[model samples]
Target: MSSQWSQGEIYESYVGRWSRLVAAEFVAWLDQPAGLRWLDVGCGTGALTTAVLTQAEPSAVVGVDPSEGFVGFARGAVADERARFEVLPAAELSTDAVGGAVDVVVAGLVLNFIPDRPDALRRMREIGRTVGVYVWDYAEGMQLMRYFWEAAADVVPDDRERDEGRTFPFCNPAGLEGLFAEAGFSDIETRAIVVPTVFESFDAYWTPFLGGQGPGPAYLRSLHPNTQTAIRHLVESRLPANPDGSIELTARAWAARGTS
Candidate 1:
């Protein structure tokens, strides 16, 4: 089944909060100076774009995504005139309305979702002097999603196909570095950004799945009620929860950067 992105609030309830934490760290790692123009490719809900505005003091931030609802949500969420959101795909971004090129371009947690990823990188290179991206290490580093998918795969054999770890091999360091090299980028580098993914209760961890935004949650909602409960039980049984009903774990995102 395909994923729908019209429900911005629901997505924020699930992944956007954690994405913001990673965005801050991603920008900090960039360590660029203030007043540089920034392009945020696949800027879902403006999490990374807002992080750059809040953390980097960029002269302007242009965010591009294919979903109108996401662009609208980001436009309303961040009112700074220095930031702008567009309902366009990463591969189609051009010079901004001011006819200006960006100093840096980055994608946060969105590269794996773009269909024509190599084309997207080439297009990003056209808009900036430096390009970079970061994605959740869904295979083993993002403990929250790893638990959900592992539990789902155990209960539903077919659900393994929908696991992002299986679908998006490009999320890893070697895979990303290969992409940059193929795209003709120089001075390439890759690193990891770690963020905490803690849930206060089983409900806190499971209720977000009902939002049905991403692939895992979409697959969860597609199941029969009893099957869904079984998967939920399986996830709960595997989590490392404490006496206070909190589940604390780390999420690692692999980030890559290179010069155009």
Candidate 2:
């Protein structure tokens, strides 16, 4: 099933919350000097844009995403006059779109979703002097989706191909670095950013999957109700839960940065 990128609130509850944590670390790692102009491509719900504004202290930022729902939600959630959001696709990114040259261009947990990555990266390079991006290590260290996909495979082996780990193999460091290099980005560097993801209860963890905003949730919604129940139960069983019923896991993202 194709992933649904709309429904900002549901996406936030499902994975945008974790995206916020990863975005903070990503911004810190970029360590760009203050007062730079930034463009946040695929800035879903302004998580990365907010991070850039708060952490990097950019002079101005323009966040762009294809989803109007996400852009509207971002505009509402982020009240800073220094930040503005637009409903535009990564492929359409340009200096004119952002109003001026950008010092830094960053995408958090979004590169893998863009249909034409090379075109998007080319645009990012043309408009900004620095480009940095991050995506979940979905094949391994993104534990939340990893556990869910494992259970999904157990329930429906034929559907194993739908797992993001399989769908987004390029989220790894080597692959990310390669993309940057191919895009003519110099001084490319890659790192892993890990953060704790503690779910208050199985419900806290499982309920988000029903939100139908991303790949795992979209897949779950595609299955029969009984099949969904089976998968959910299996996921609960396999997760390492605490005596108090909380689930603790770590999410890792591979980040890459390069000079244009």
Which candidate comes out best when scored by lDDT? 2
Off by over 4 Å in 2: 1-3
How well does each candidate superpose onto the true structure, as a TM-score? 0.96, 0.98
Q: List the residue pairs that clash in candidate 1.
A: none
lDDT (10s digit) by residue, model 1, range 122-204: 87887799998999998989998999999999998866788889998888989999988877788999999999988899899
Best model number under TM-score: 2
Task: List residue ranges in candidate 1 displaced over 4 A.
Answer: 1-3, 96-98
lDDT of each: 0.87, 0.90
User: Worst 10-residue stretch by lDDT in candidate 1?
Assistant: 90-99
lDDT of 2 at 67: 89
TM-score of model number 2: 0.98
Give the lDDT of residue 6 in candidate 1: 63
lDDT per residue for candidate 2 within 1-260, as digits (tens), equals 12488878998988899999999999999999999999999888899999898998889999998888898999999999999998888877888888889899999888988887777888899999999999999999999999999999999999989999999889998999888888888999999999999999999999999988899998899999999999999999999999999999999999999997
